[model samples]
Target: MNSNSDVTSRTVTALGPQLRRRKSIKHMVGEAESNSGQLRRTLGMWQLTMISVGATMGTGILVILGAAVPIAGPAIWISFVIAGVTALLSAVSYAEMAGMVPVSGSSYSYSYATMGEGIAWICGWCLVLEYAVSVAAVAVGAGEYVNQTLRTFNMELPVSLAGGPAEGGVVNLPALIVVVLATLLLVRGARESAIVNTVVVIIKAGILVFFSIVAFSAFNAGNFEPLLPMGAAGVTAAASSVFFSYIGFDAASTAGEEAKNPKRDLPRAIMLSMLIVTITYVLVAVSAIGAREWTWFVGTEAALVQIVGELTGQPIFVLIFALASVLAIASVVLTVLYGQTRILMSMSRDGLVPAVFGKVSKRTGTPVAGTLITGIVVAITAGFIPLGALADATSIGTLFAFALVGVSVMYLRKRQPQAPRTFRVPLYPITPILGIFACLFLMSQLGWHTWVVFLIWMLVGIVIYLGYGRRRSRLGQLSKQDYIASHVGENQ
Candidate 1:
């Protein structure tokens, strides 16, 4: 027993002061204030909701219908509903945690407060894949739409520059350009990026609404006859795919540090965003199915535009759809790039990742180095990888991160009941439990390859933690007095 104690004491001593900071609610709030004061708190509830909606609404809405409908038939509409509810539950859990913790790192920061240094590192690594790959995938999708729009005027890039080698071309130059531009915007600072994002959001949402209305004119009731042709399993499979459309709801949580009243706004923004996106998704899916047969979607480039063009019997509709897609996807790349940098900043502060990732530009108050590195990685992926594979990998990482957040909420509630929360999950254990199970179900539906990639990525995170994070962590430095004082002040 004595020998075991000695070994444990040595192990504890080795974790470093930063890793053992024992962040209390007060310190968490203080940290958020310090990092985010440079950002203007100009967003109200509605703008916040719109930001979430803009981030969540993207290529998935335009692309997934074709991919999902073949699996679930007309019943894919129901799958959208299922996926939306599951996402909403998780969003609610995130909202509560964001409100209570009010920190910028999303799951990474929350996990640190509740699960300790090691788990937080893993969560942060998962987010790297989620945000970076998402930006790349969205950029690739945007590139396709841009090409489609250009084709309206009989203008097209050389085949080599338009697609990857796997697609019988060489490089996706347009996609690379999009990622690089988004990175530059992010490095400039939050205010400008948010404004650009807001404009993109409005354009995208407007186009989606326009598509819904016009597509309805071509609606044929006959398309509804074969609902659920693929059965319940098919609907579930489609739900997993449709779940990708909801990816950006957590973007609101990442702004926990910047929100003027995080406790009041964060949860509201999350749920409201989920609600708006769900409605838009259901409308778009129903309209698309009513406009065309399901199988026509397979292997079709610019599927949504094609659907609208075919339904309306006018090529102009395709041009409009393509333009809308470009704007939406651009917003996704921008928001995701911002999220990646912010999470890295949080990890750097905790000393779990390189300190350079956390370095904020004194003038801009943005993570310049981190954003540049992320942009470069995204550009490489966009220029080389296939969109389908990148999208699957992103979904797997995001689902894992979401499930972890749900679990963290439950863990914190039970472990720190006295901790003040500005907002609480409406259904308590049921909401979080269902959220975790839902995320797990979606994750399992991803291809076996995605799981393998995720596992390998996680192993890399573990190695990094053991090699560096554990030794440099802020948590390790906390004395008993510091821990008690931090918690006590928050409680008061």
Candidate 2:
């Protein structure tokens, strides 16, 4: 066999050395903090929750609502609840794994120590798709809102600078600009980014709350007459579509290495962020339909503006809502981009990618190189790709990653029955099994085109693993030592 084939064949064996090759719980705990030049543990529960909150509460509500209300009618509020419940299953699994592993790779690192190197690579690859594409998708929506706000002031930008070729534009300048700004903020430092995120989250939440109050004042009970206009199927489809908003609660777990008290605080942050986001979404959905007819929301990108304009005949409120949407989308881009870079850094540390990505800047305590690389790639993608299909890809990628983390929690419980765990998934295997199935059910609701794209992405990941990552893995070196130790035990 050639050297590459030799490496690929043995990569599966990396999982078999559970007795000798498994990373001990204690080792992972120390590694989370002992590397003096590594990511600093500076985030507490509040900052970490804001990262998840700021990331989760963006374009999903502002953009997806326009597309979803036409299908689910006034019953769209039920869709939000369904999506939130689905997220909660995987989230509990995340809490358990984050508390146990306490590392930067999120699901990827948890899979490494429990499942094996190959699964870890695939999990990490899925996360890259999730975060990077999510950033691109959010940027596109942010650009649209920014342009709309400008037009409201009688300041029109050229079509070429405002959108992609799909929208008859040469390039998406506004989308590219937001990506660059978020990247610069990320490179500054994690704590600084967290602080900015907290401020943004407060402002975004306040705007939504104010919008809800205004919407409810003009409430007409008659608007909700035909709640499930399209029936249960429509609600299910809308739930699957709206699930994109909840993807970022898991981003909190990616900051495991930078959390002050990861074990207790990580779980708290995940649950708290989810609760806050779910409540906010439900209020907005109800108030929106109550404010006007559901037909008014269909095919409209600026539903908030349209609703406010109709309510008060005032351009000022419409502009305020438009500006808030712009800022909210920008914050989502920042948080998810931060997540993508961190995941790449963790994978790089395992020799699954180039070591350059793993480089930490001592002055900033951040992965500057990875952050810049992710920024450029996402900027290009945002500047060109249309948002429709890419958004589905982000949701599918996240569901896949969540399913893997859910399974990893179950596998670890069986393999390391005595491992020290500060937190554990409630109801044992039921929680993870539900999490996995819930993700699969939602994945089934997406169109066939999304599955085709997801499969192609997975194939590319497999090729990279065989061609480059297999031979270079740091885990291989450790596995060899364990292999020799196993033989030595046999001889003894």
Instruction: Tell me the TM-score of each prediction against the true structure.
Output: 0.92, 0.93
Relative to the unseen true structure, what is the C-alpha lDDT of residue 374 in candidate 2, on a scale of 0 to 100? Answer: 90
Q: List candidate 2 segments past 4 Å from native.
A: 1-25, 483-492
Q: Please, what is the whole-model Cα lDDT of each candidate in the order they appear?
A: 0.78, 0.84
lDDT of candidate 2 at residue 317, scale 0 to 100: 81
| TM-score of predicted structure 2 | 0.93
**lDDT per residue as tens, model 1, 1-492:** 355543454365545444444455567778767766554455566556666776789988887777778889888889999999888888888888888887778988877777666667777888888877777877877667888899888998888988887777888888888888889998887777878888888888888898888778888878877887888889988898888888878887777665667778888888888878999899998888887777666666666787667667777877877887887887888887887887887878876778988787777877788889878988988988776654677777888888888988988888778877878888789999998998898888877887787787788878888887775665554444544666774322
What are the per-residue Cα lDDT tens digits for candidate 2 across 96-153? Answer: 8888887878988887776667778888889988999888988988777887788778
Candidate closest to the true structure, highest lDDT: 2
